[model samples]
Target chain A: MSDGVEVSVVLPAYNEADTIEETVRVTLETLDSFLPAGAYEVIVAEDGCADRTPEIAARLAREDDRVRHVHSDERLGRGGALEYAFERARGETLVYFDTDLATDMRHLEELVESIRTDGYDVATGSRWLPENRADRPAKRGIPSFGYNTLVRTVLRSDLRDHQCGFKAFDRTALESLLPAVGDEHWFWDTEVLVKAQRRGYRVKEFPVDWTPKGDSKVDIVRDVFGMGSQILRTFWELSVSPRITRRVSLGAGTALVVVALLLMTQYLDPQAVLTRMAGADPGIVLASALVYAVSWPLRGARYRDILSSMGYREHWGFLTGAVFISQTGNLVFPARAGDAVRAYVVKARRSIPYPTGFASLAVERVFDLLTITLLAGVVMVALAATGSADQLLVALTDGAVGATRPPAGGPLSPSPPASASPPSLQ
Target chain B: MTAIVASARTDRNFVRRTVGALSDDSYADYVAGVVERFVGDVQTVAADASAFGRVGGASLLIWSLDVVTAIVVFAAFGVDVTLAVVAVGFFAVSVGNLAKVLPLTPGGVGLYEGAFTLIMAALTPVGVATALSIAIVDHAVKNVVTIAGGVASMAWLNVSLTKAVEESQSAGDVEVEADD
Candidate 1:
């Protein structure tokens, strides 16, 4: 059992009374061939546990000296626990894995070997990425889709799997990135990779066999959401730091501000415009307001639908906020700058890409238009039969679609006969 | 799932019926086509169309409210019945088409209402026309204000419209673009 320390196995466990022992047994059994029998110590940083997870872990520690266990009464969560384990690991290349064995032992060995002998700075399990970790349930896969998206956009981290827990890091890369990752919970995966990536570290992913940890404590909503924000925070921090070489531009924001200022001028005389507005009919005002307030949720829903269809899952609150913000931007910024803003926010918060985000938006608009067109044709014709066609026609013709129609009689309407308008070569 | 089911109830009756009236079967067929085409183009087919990280839920609401808003305002302003039909119908179709041109109005705030009023006013009675106009202008003002707020928030959030629109577009390659 004589061997030099090549791979250090760091297991960050919180409360794994049900499956941890199995995870260690499998790893030890499988890893004995690859590395020396006593070369590796399974450094288990047992985070504050309320159950027998710590006690059981301690018992195992006594059975094999290689099974080292450290108890930190203060719960540093997933990220902090791993940080501790990595710091105390005995191997030259530190590898931290999920205690539930989501990543199978064979893949774990592969991961360690990929970095130990090879020159890779970090190796992670990618479920949907090029080197996919493993097959995942729709629930797990769906959230990863969203998490990866947010990571790509907000942090500009190119890695496809943002939340994969089974990963190995070179001691140099780990030491460099570990300090920057503050999230004590889930997002720590991205924090480290993004930081590592930004620092010119070579990170690679491999598809590995993994099982969805059945008794896993991952609160998808709370933990995922919290990680999303932290991902953005890390991205921002990385992007702004002179120490990091990778960053992206916040595009056209200044020009957007300039145009927004111009649009604000229109509402300045809301009272004054009343006469002009009411002259045309106050009905339009009320209708317009209804459209504005109500569209928020609808637009949000549209986004939700597209993402769901795309297999990306997120909370409705985040989506609605995205729609509200984006639509609101389009309204004020005359040049359609709101779309950019909306995409940026969502990308920042959700870790999805801008291109993918806006694609859904285009679809929502088309559907919306088709719906509007249908109403106009049928309802207007009905009004025409009732002799109210003129008013409805006026509304439709005046560019109710959010553009200025040919002014009252300037060219298109009532000023001259249709034949005389000369088709205007529009 | 419930929210999705609830929102997916896009009130096809209105869309279907509206499309159904063009020229008997012609109208119905046309409506059906419009529905198909519209549904086809929407982000429903795309995988990543959302505001931030959530999905889009505003289509039905936006469409329904457009109709309801028009009907209510026209009624409230004491618009003549005859004029209401044309203005309401006219704005309805035009609003959707307008979205096509811009490819990115966010939520069609000021432009939608303003254009709706201008287009509808020319074809209706003074009373009805005036009411519809006011409805549109008010919506525009609010929309403009909302856009302003969104811009402010974008600044706070440090995002851009291009990023939002492009990301959404990336969710599905509908090939739809901003014409205006």
Candidate 2:
């Protein structure tokens, strides 16, 4: 109701009929102590109250011009109610505190002045700071400590007490941050503060005297589980989503491959494989590995040619690396998932369109299949020229027991025992 | 060549219809351009007759190296280097690589080994154990080489695979927005 309200204090009320009148009176008296008449306004954000809290707020708004009553038919959550009232408030500096007024009223001036005159973007009272005078019971204190610690560690926040209700925000700063803040309920405060810091806003956290109030509506399941998921969501949005650059993708891909390799040991004994590999001629195996290594650059060259024909000329080294990453992704992921990975790499790194990337990859694959068929066809012709056609027929049909074509159900048949005699060399 | 062109046309139309159904007219048009560009690239390759010859040469050379790797693994097992066995190894390697293209498993690990072992065992006088050993060793060597090259390339390119996957996953919407 004030004409030139510089500060608006919103009290989010949900069925607080017993204390609404006294809380508003005390809030008015506190405002009168420091602010000039008509300089500040008190908004009772009555959020779908089932009791007479809305009536009391309406009466107070009517009785005093400094008090304003805003009612919501539906339960706009705590943060929602505050946001609703703040948008309607005619103030450059917006402040909000719990209806309980657990924090000493003496700190109210400091909280408002920090944003109004001190030039800070946000200011919040802390109950977790070493210098605080909060008389917290063990039941509340332990969970609060754990929650705040989690917020600090997971969200990378600097604030010690994020959920402190006694907080003030610069109107412009709050508005700039609200669009990105996804939470509507209890996680709102932590998200806002974390995002505020990330966006380079100067936030001030001051210790305040506080007393433990009566039973709060903190459900064990919702607060712990629901908010726990919210933390991960915010962490992803704040820390992971924006920075999902090519480097992070490669790192994640590598991590996935490593995890896949680790998981393979559960199904296949790695020690047995390593021992078998060791039993082989190490020199010949090294040569084989080197020969395979040489093919990678050629693979890169083929990829470059395919892309170049598409009018997207790129460095051969870069193409080779892209091929390598995609192939590696394929090695660890199923159904040629690495193909898309390669497409993604080229599109992201070279600004080539996705369609082109995919097409170039397809072109490369066509050549691969063609080359494979050509090799098999040439070898088949050679076998026929040498009077070995009968051997090919027998192999195609059934030559020996346990040596037929792989079954349709699975690729790997049971391995024969190690002591089995080596078959004829030629 | 005719099959490639026909497939290209079918793909372009499919892309256009699919995109048109999902988005607005302007966005669909932009997506159609994307498909056109893709089809154009494939057709360009198909048009250049020598491009096929050159790619064939490269692929043959690369796949020959792959066959050579298998031959070397056979040599490590002390198999005689007979022309008949080498020819059989070439066929088995080619067929094994083709089997891997099925995408049944990562890098077709089990699939490649199965096909190679089956062909080598049936064609030659090799025991199942020796054939499976050769198949496993050959596939493992190639896979190890591939993984090493991939890691080296990642470090060299200074790009993130995770980020690329994420962006590529959301590429449809992002491309439409950019074009619109």
Compare the candidates by DockQ and give the number of the best one.
2
A8-72 per-residue lDDT for model 1 (tens digits):
78777777788879888887777787776666778778888777889988998999877888888
TM-score per candidate for chain A alone? 0.57, 0.63
Q: What CA RMSD would you report for each candidate?
A: 17.7, 15.6
lDDT at position B170, candidate 1:
56
Q: Lowest-scoring 10 consecutive residues by lDDT in candidate 2 chain B?
A: B171-180
TM-score of each: 0.44, 0.49
Native A-B contacts reproduced, model 2: 0.51
lDDT of 1 by residue, B1-180 (tens): 222222234543545554444322222332354354444334245323343223223444565555555554444344333444434544643563464355333344434544554455444333223433545544554556466556565665566666565665554334333211
Superposed on the true interface residues, model 2 gives a C-alpha RMSD in angstroms of 12.6
The superposed Cα distance between candidate 1 and the true structure at residue A404, in angstroms, equals 14
Could you give candidate 2's per-residue lDDT for residues A132-234 as a string of tens digits? 7787778888888899999999999999999999999999999999998887777788889999999999999999999868875455434654578689989
- In candidate 2 the C-alpha lDDT for residue B129 amounts to 52
Every model's DockQ: 0.14, 0.23
Which regions of candidate 1 are displaced past 4 Å?
Answer: A1-4, A129-133, A215-224, A239-426, B1-180
Clashing pairs in 2: A246-B160, A247-B160, A249-B161, A249-B162, A249-B163, A250-B160, A250-B161, A250-B162
What TM value does model 2 have?
A: 0.49
